[model samples]
Target chain A: MDMKINIAGVELDNPIIAASGTYGFGHEYNEFYDISEIGAISVKGLTKSPRAGNPPPRITETIGGILNSVGLQNPGVDAFIKEEIPFLRKHRCKIIANMAGNTFEDYCEMAEKLSAADVDMLEMNISCPNVKAGGAAFGTNPDTVLAITKAVRTYAKKPLIVKLSPNVADITETAKAAEAGGADALSLINTLTGMAIDINTRRPILANVVGGLSGPCVKPVALRMVYQVHQAVKLPIIGMGGISNGDDAVEFLLAGSTAISVGTANFTDPYACLKIRDGIKTYMEKHQIKTVRELTGGLIVESK
Target chain B: MSYQDYSCQICSQQEIAPNIIACCLENAHLAKNAKPGQFLHIQCGDPASMPLRRPISICDVNGDELTIIYEVKGRGTKALREQTGKVQVLGPLGNGFLVDNSLYKRPAVIGGGIGTYPLYLLTKQLTNASVYLGFRNQSVVTLEQEFCQVAEKVTITTDDGSYGVSGFAITQLEEDHKKEVFDIVYACGPKPMLRAVQAFAEKTGVPCQLSLEERMGCGIGACLTCNCETHEEGSAHYKHVCKNGPVFWSQEVVL
Candidate 1:
């Protein structure tokens, strides 16, 4: 079994990573677990300028999960590159910078700056509904997905991992478009657009009428999409959605993810990422698998 | 970068009073550092009821553990109450009270409704203090005898005259001040009550510090969800209740 696999041209110690927004720039979870425990970290979605973020009621929890419309809130690209980048570099992990843009230009500007900054990869966010240009408009249409991916891919010197939104009619067409646009790798599925209603008040639970849903409820949907997209495109795939424990992480990898990102779980337990990290090695050792890279999409298909 | 949330296990859960529960946590370190008037961010469920965590104030600290007492208010609080065993809590966070006993000969502790939870610990830290707590009626009055153990005088007020004193808590705290001259006033509870205490402290020109309340996210200061405007400015020109204070000098806050 080979331990080394390539994401674009860069090498990661493992295929497990703490996802964006959930990890909060990796510096935070470092307090509970060692930074070296995970393969990489996708920092929170950053824009061209600092964002104080949306007004209150940005987050609410539902019966099996939580919904959020944080509006891609961050201290902007400059602060992230200046203040946040140095801290990320101190840790031994592949730093995947997640970039969000209100317009194509904001995407280009952030990608260009982060490309020059010290980072191993760039994760382009096309699924965020918090911004006008984000959400379904950029994700649903294949041509728009291609155009935006092409635009950001030009400025990104590192591996450009275009995150695909699952709020579309067909996931394959969109994944193919990202491949056509030169995405080095792909990630799915970004939070599905969802809303919860307060029956007594007859009002939406979120301050924003709608929000993105992530957690255990969406795992089957995400796994099915990852499997579908894996067949549609040749790009290395990073899968995420309601992943909590090592068993869940293995399920995503076996479903055809080259790597997996742990979201929602970080809030359930701050040390959840480290738990998955250790759990993966234990799983591999028990199965007599010498390397995690061997587990990527290694599911034995049973006859229907 | 200094903040993170964890799934805190319930070490001990005690029913301190009717509709009020005192929860002890497995966090040895948190119980070690919490001071009077401090708070903790609770994740009501494994995935959290809201995208963020709910903030609760510390009621007592014993050894490597701390206690938070609360009445079920909404979904977040309701989820916390239903947690069968251990629940996740983020704190002992926010600045606790200023208990510098050297500056004041006598201290007065005031709490209103569920806000009295923090005052239970605040009065214990003062050299000499009186406990004045108020609730809606017989259903809300909690921790009276426990407060009596720490305070020189324990005054309980209920709106229906079902408890010790009739009328509001402020009326009880200000009934008279001639004993030792309460030089410092400390308080917690709903904002209206804290405001009333602030008014009396200002009228007497007595040094006062009030325990404030705000819903929080990351209790260590990173997430700005719990920010409140004050006379003091930090990196962002606002003080975070989860970090700089859930406890602030009465004068330092805008209201």
Candidate 2:
């Protein structure tokens, strides 16, 4: 099966990419299997400077997913380029540098610095829901989303994919705002804001009080947002939320995603990307689809 | 390393205590690679019902089979008890305990409640160590016979004096250490007990290693959710309990 997918001119061997914050630089998962077998690895969330992340109890399990408030813990952009990139370069997969910034300047600086680095693409994350300051704030407002996207676009030499947050009133408005800002492509939804509590202790389960919920629970909402954004914007979409298998990936593609990212599922099974890729291949071959492009926007809506 | 799931058939399952059960699985790779302080992430229940895998410690390892003892804590664990035929496990994860026989000839091992499960393998590796165990009361006390067989001397303590020595296990350990002047101390338990052990180890100038526990996601380093506070250079830093360690030197953690 032809599993190849192109997002804003960047060609991927397969359509299964490991989402940001879930797959660490690919070094850890590489211990289990050859990570290059997947389409690409969205490395851990990066920032202008190194972050220690949140306090203990950063994660809590829910019915069908997990809530995390890791607060973008990573060894700044420079360290990632120096220490993490060399390791990733050894692999044959595409490298999508997922970056987080506290301010506009921070985002611009990181984008400018990484433009000269050996990375395939830049995933601008203005929608991380865990941090208190700049993460979700810029993503929630249309003005800031456009401003940040346009500002980062000035220096981001590689293909820039703007990641959208799900904790918004209308996702299409934010999607259109990113399109207006000159984003090469888009990906969503970056964890819905949620909370879990410990009844015995009578306190919030996560130290941050609330966290971003991911896994199978958020798939329906993510699919709806992707379908809406595909209708609202012309930019190609890299859809992700609670995508667990090839069936879930196909749903995103049918809903109008150029490619799909496997997020929280990587935690449950490190080989989820490989399995999803194979699952897509099995589905396509069984359905007699010639190419993955044929599956994109394949959803048939019934008219009354 | 990459975490992969292995399906191992159940060798045996027995209830060691009121709510605790010891399950043995037959898997050669896990039996060979798993160490004293490391743990396994077991996928509990059917795929449709369970989202997260429960992390359980290696209670004992014999030949090609390993034992995991768990208490019924929540729905995740309660679901684990119903396993039959084969079970999927991802493991031997996190840095295991560092056991240097040359460093300490007379070692003291302390464990409280479920925390004792991880220390079992550590005790078996030592030549002549002293094992101190603490439980809520008589009904919850477990692995007494197992520890007795491994350690040169064993001390069991209960909070309400239902069995063994009364009072906290640390008190007994402190009282015994004065006469023995042990070279090394190892501990795993509740925060308060670990804190007390840390204080004693620091004051006595004895090196100690502790197996810390926390709520985790992706028993690998990627998720950075199982964080623990550690002090370095007059400031506090965070390390992932899943990767950086489930085991750390006594003074390395802030508790």
Candidate 3:
């Protein structure tokens, strides 16, 4: 019955947070439904300065997934803090500022700026592959992960959630590195790098040639990584990747994630988070579970 | 505008030209509210099989029936071509065309190939508008008769000398402008054609609005996909084509 979740001292009425880049400042979705109905919203990826992003043809569809090369096109952090934060502050749910940068200084500057701002959490987006640099690079290596997480920790006054990259060799290593570097919590898995070709045109579908793949296709990989990282670290995990419904959210919760974020599913249905939240409630009721926390790490597997 | 996805009955489906199909659906709200240049994101295949919805421009809206014209581009549209009966769609979405009658009393409408589809709605709304359409050749020329019925004057052209006019549509528009000057120009088509119109608008000191086509993730503003750079004064800003516009002021965007 109780769907509340506490991630790094920040409380969510429910465990559904709209993933960054997928949910833009909550203005668009707010037009569809009362966005305050959802648990929280992670605004679009932000940087120190405005970014123009990639060229046209930034998105290409795949089997049960999509590849996006949006390149973090945003109106800069100052714009977000000036123009967007006040609007976001009007909502009842927590606001997680998803920050991306082309360099370490950019991340630190954004971390410091957002820390003193009105946001509830800082979600460091180190796994964006659509950009040329400082995106997936910081998330792929344990050293960079530790270094960036450590560096960002100094400036981030709010809870720091290091979003892990699935493109890495072992996700647990990076998750452990973030934990070692003082991450309050973690979220995963940012889209997996993939490409699709236009057979008719004999060219890549996306202008960027390669993009991060997300949606139902990557859910299994996301669940596996969340489970592995949960065992490797003691931090609460925000699991995501193709989470379309409450059943999918339940899968992530049982895989040791305290909460889940809806990404690609938001494209298919604007009220995906609300549906997912209701689905989890229905799932809990049917299973006679009292609280969603009971579903965390509830997976029963036999040792081979 | 409401953003919830709706399931509408497929009233009919007809192939208007080679590789192009016109689908008519019965959705009262969309038909009543959908404006020129607004699009619908239709669920192409089974929800489980295809997670991404295909964004299609509304070609015509009559009472409770909304028609969309699309060319088979990929697996999504290929699947859409086979859809029948009831289909789920999320839209009447994005910022539609702003047809400020005060901005331009007499307007010129230009369309290239599939780009001409959305202009049908725009031309219908304009009381006095000139329509110029360009295609590959006579064989692929579509909606010529429809434009002729709505437009004050209609000019059709082809890349090769096989149809109404011997040259590009922009050339025809330029030639016609000398005979009768247009207060404004509205266009949709290939990128180069749009770029040409943008230049023409600047050179002639006439206002122009262009509808852009970009690959999109969410036809709504959620996903930052479908980004197009816009220039205001000397600064450049990015806008989501799916949200901010499929249609923008001529000088506002960089083609």
RMSD from true fold, candidate 1: 4.0
lDDT of 3 by residue, B1-255 (tens): 357789999999899998999999999988998999999999887766688888899999999999999999788989889988898888888777778777778899999999999999999988888999999998889998898888898889999979898889999888878878899999999999999999999999888889997888778776777878777421146777887898898888888
Candidates, DockQ: 0.28, 0.62, 0.61
Q: Who wins the TM-score comparison?
A: 2
Model 1 DockQ vs. reference: 0.28
Better of 1 and 2 by lDDT: 2
Error (Å) of candidate 3 at residue A287 is 1.0
lDDT accuracy of residue A263 in candidate 1: 78
Q: What is the TM-score of chain B alone in each candidate?
A: 0.89, 0.96, 0.95
> Per-residue lDDT for A42-133 in model 1, tens only?
98888787765654456666666667776666777898899988888888888999887778888888888888999999999888865564
TM-score of each: 0.85, 0.98, 0.95
Candidates 2 and 3 compared by DockQ, better number: 2
Better model by DockQ: candidate 1 vs candidate 3: 3
Scored by DockQ, the top model is 2
lDDT of each: 0.77, 0.88, 0.89
Question: Which residue ranges in model 2 land beyond 4 Å of their true spot?
Answer: B1-3, B233-236
B73 in model 2: Cα distance from truth in Å? 0.8
